[model samples]
Target chain A: MTSIRRRQVIAGLAMAPFISRYPLASKILGRLVIIGGGFAGATLARFAKALEPRLGVTLIEARSRYTACPMSNLVLAGERELNQQTFDYKALAEAGVQVIQDYAVDVDGAQQRVILQGGERVEYDRLVLAPGVQLNFDQLSGYSRQGAQDMPHAWQAGAQTTLLRRQLQAMPDDGLAIISVPPAPYRCPPGPYERASLMASYFKQAKPKARILILDSNDRFSKQALFQQGWQDLYGDTIRWQSASNDGRVNRVEPASMRVHTDFDTYQPDVANIIPPQQAGDIAHRAGVTDSSGWCPVESVSFESNRQPNIHVIGDAAIAAPMPKSAFAANAQAKVCAIALVRLFRGIRPEPTVLANTCYSYLKPGHAISIAGAYRTDNGEFSAIAAASGASPIDATQALRQQEAAHAADWFSAIIQETFG
Target chain B: MGRYHAILPMLVLGLTPCGYAQGAPSALSQSASQAAVCSGCHGKLSGVAVPALVSDARVLEQQMLALRQEGGDSAMHRLIHAYDETQIRGIAEALASQKNPPAAQSTGP
Candidate 1:
């Protein structure tokens, strides 16, 4: 055995008396119920069970199959199929987690029970909510749940992804396609730009005369310099970007005529992807965990809800600033939370933890850029470790971009297998 | 036995003086949890361009330390700066000892 293992053994022996004196040492740990079966919830369920086999874990998901959002942009560019982005919860269920296929209507935190749509009440000693972002269609004028069908957001992936791809395919050779990006604090910071890049790549090959425009509500974006440099290098003059200061903040849309309205002008593009504003999923509001910002606040170490006790929030729904709402961040948060919950169940004080995230955005097929950061809990909040956080260099070599692209594909495959497979 | 082996290390770490005073997790637990994030990219499947986390502990620690000081803008270099030598060593040891690591690679989608 290694020296570390030997130290751990000695440490364990020293703690034996303290372990015996612990109040809950002999009793069985109660149930742990998680809502949403995405990266955060599914990973938490599996890891929590693996850590403590005695803890009963149940995963509740509204949909039987999940269409991942990370790689869905590739689907729009015809580089990937929607089926490739989809997964079922059979693997999670097979891993000894009781998987429930039903909508969680409300969470009764006082009673530690979750109410399902069909009147089923699932009780839990602890609960985790990983429900991702919900688009706020009401925030934008001339847009609603129905209007999204015509002017597809394709933000959540699935049918809308297909709709946008089909519309792009049907457009004329010289047609214009406009992608409208919402303000800051959206699901994925680099997603809209990645979509714009991939779409331009598609139009470059399929319709050489086509034009693509990006209308941004924000003045700057994540990896802006790198994306601008890539646009200049890969698809010059084919793509144009307008910031909010340049009248690019889209406030209205007429899906019937494919018209998008900004502060200064109105353009009728052949295709429009209007990504609406977003908030924590509805159940978080119902659970009384969300603050006025439409996101849940939680203790950084444990991810336990600040508004309600015994309820933890992770993933896109939680206000994990400095850590973008990406699949990688959610997966890391889930593992830390699993560790915290396991200790808490055993009547042990939870430990402050560290988390990391890496997001890769493909500039084109076999070419990609990336951003990475590490976060640590300080003074009850998560702050970025400045020395260890940055994006790919703007002047990166083509070889490095290609390698990062392969890493991006590898990342998607690894995360999919870890979460669903 | 495997399960206990994993839990005992964490338990001992949690109760140690360094872990208890400031509520800071021991380097072992912190590194073990942080290592899970690596699985999001470096899986043990074939056809993967990213290297898997299956290196010798000392070599992994040395390489990570070297990368941290290299001061490049690559993702690995930037991320490795977050960890100190102790945590890096802990991560290397934890990953090296894992019987079943976190992730696996497959083909597209």
Candidate 2:
């Protein structure tokens, strides 16, 4: 939640109640309603309370538990269990955030209310929407809701993750496994590659004769050089990747036949993980907050929807380009949004926004790669400060790679503790 | 909008140096907005190999200035540009103050 700064702001606000200048308005800051209680919503709720205990924050989530998509790849490779990635709202509730176990079916932006599936209406002075992405299964032929049951995307985690893991475990020693990656702006840029790396690791250990194939829609991917180098060092040609320029775009998938059709050819595989194209969560569409791009456009400083007033969007759903859609990015955005809202409640102008993200992808158990950046919205848009943004060096020492692996583990623990601990 | 209009004068006044009491130690008492961004990746909770920002304000400021001057499009150069000297000073002080008063343990919300 960007604790130190936020805490100071809250502390200062306490000392000088600027809102008190308006004698008649007792509570300038009233209720805050947040939808999709994942990283963004949960952190927003907690930070709002920490900044100003009197501010009423309510988080509405459809699911009982949230299994983070960040480290779920480790689960797919059987390196980590789905349980390690699972989180609930118990801690948030204990922190005085009214966590509702219900689906937010629609948002009445004008009325400032979130309508639930149960017909109950939750109203607020401000609304925050952090619904993650929704996979567009229709983009791929022969892939639908039911098809996902057989060949899971595992993009949203939980059941799909477990299904993919089980599929990998059941494949024969010499079986071929394919991971079809969609075009850019997908949930996690490095995810498919990381999954491929871990898959290679798993196969190298369990199914020595097994080969892992990556069918990608993009010409190049995040941390490409490092990933290629690691694959060569660890599994050699056992892991093969075909870029879009080389017919890597998978046009169709026949789950029934266990085959995927690219532009140039079709290949049958023992198991396939097809991550489809994505859009903002369903509710964003209902609220009319998304643009033609299928993402919610937000004012850089406040993350407030440019289409709708007082409704802010964060996380993967938000079109905060240059900042990849990641758990850390969402966590950083949540704090900025929370701070902006607090300042607005007190009738103060929102401060300049500064956001950052550090993403780590493990190559093997002891080796990892990372990309990091610090960003600011001085001109009302977020961009990586050329000086402050970069990925792990190409020719890093083995010791450095191992150190980064430890950092990755530490980052995971720290974020989880900060968000839900 | 009307409420915002009513508070502008007060906000302008609050920005004055007199708004805060004199000799109020900067570190623990400074606004955390600028410094908090660093905490996202470098704090005790973040667990990365990067050193925590919990150090003397002067020392932290020098490091930030170095990153700003010599970081050269690196992540360090980009992140440090978000603040001016005052903001950086505030951040360094806040982080320094927190070093002694252990960070709060995160538990069930």
Candidate 3:
């Protein structure tokens, strides 16, 4: 064969696994069970079936509908609705996946069974936990589950988001609103900033005299420059950001008086959105996969729990830094995990892996910024390839912002379909 | 005794035949799995101008190779740099070969 033809032949073989069709055998392989029907687990359940039709994939989710946190800020701003962000599992059920509505109380790695809250045990050949994040309410001095009802964190969407919205709407003109951001290694690094922008957007029109004070635990945040610039140009003195060095971190909260106290000062605001510290969800700990950091340690390539065999962890629950815990990251990790599980069931060792993340933060309606990159794992350590990642330029035109905003919306739809459908 | 007879009962004990049928482990394609990751960003934008990968293999290859050649300290470059020419070609072909439903595009942000 000619040299060019030889290279082509080699390339074809390398690509064959991706393109080749497996025989449609209606036979059993093994039972694959997934906990949490969010971005990672749902996508894994869907893709596993696509890869191997006979793989018995069962997804256990406590909630009937998923409200995407990616664009839930829009819902908070009234630009979108909760119903719009919410999605049901009918599509997944139609695809032969057994969707169970129950909380996974415990995961027994030895027996490979997930014990539901109602005392039923479901068996699995492979168990995947994509339980996302659980808020560390104890991290803050006076913050508790009940305290959240009064001073909404609104981080996980649903009721808290609506309560914060109502509070913002009820605030009188010239009222001060406080937003407290937690330190790093949190879900969606840019999320609190996005919420601040949307709240500012609503207040700008509704109560022009209202002001927002952002108390950040970190010295810096994602897209800080772009977000700061947008605040300056658009909101104009309505939003003020304090870095951690300046006592920007909130040390305590007085929910009764609606006051948040920082290291340097205290602010009595009409509305407060306090995003507390976060860790892996409950099931990861129950599965005995979480490490000292309260996050699951996984082999980067397959996302299999480092502490437990036959169980994989993905999304915010996994310790995949350099890669932020965004919905997009979860979706990408799910695909990799699904394929790895499929390969393992067939007794084939999974290959080295590549993953990707594209996080878009809307600074305001019809304007946004994004950071995108690809990741690879070597010897179980994950690293982002800087050459393949980038952020939108700081000095972007309005037209460009509009285009990016459009892209952000399109991405949201795509991801929902990819995960749910 | 036959060699297969020794493990027969173990197979019945271990494998649940009512669920997913077990078969000899076959290697899954790395390119296909990686391409599935791309749909997170590039696929399903109905009216948005994302470079489509599902329609053609050569287009996907050209864009990926171009990004790889246009070397900079960018994230996309670093991502592609991790893969060899063979892997890139495989990914492009895998994306092209997928016959899944076209992602429903969104008209709003």
**DockQ of candidates 1 onward, in order?**
0.28, 0.13, 0.20
Q: After superposition, how far is residue B96 of candidate 3 from its true place, in Å?
A: 0.9
Model 1 RMSD vs true structure: 10.2
* Alpha-carbon deviation at A291 in model 1, angstroms: 0.9
Q: Which stretches of candidate 1 lie over 4 Å from their true place?
A: A1-27, B1-28, B43-55, B70-73, B102-109
* Candidate 3: docking tier: incorrect
lDDT of 2 by residue, B1-109 (tens): 2221221111111111111223433211224444444423322222212233323456655655655565432233345565677866665554444432212332211
Interface RMSD, prediction 1: 6.4
Q: What is the TM-score of each candidate against the true structure?
A: 0.87, 0.84, 0.85
Model 1 chain A worst lDDT window (10 residues): A16-25
In candidate 1, position A362 carries an lDDT of 87
In the range A220-317, model 2's lDDT, one tens digit per residue, is 98789989988998898999999999999999999988889998799999999989999999999999999998999998888889999989999999
Best candidate, lDDT = 1
| Residue A267 alpha-carbon offset, candidate 1, angstroms | 1.4
- Cα deviation at A187, candidate 3, in Å, is 0.9
Candidate 3 per-residue C-alpha lDDT over A138-221 given as tens digits, one digit per residue, 9 for 90 to 100: 999999999998899998878887898888888888899899998888998339888889888988888889999999999988
How many steric overlaps are in each model, in order?
Answer: 0, 18, 23
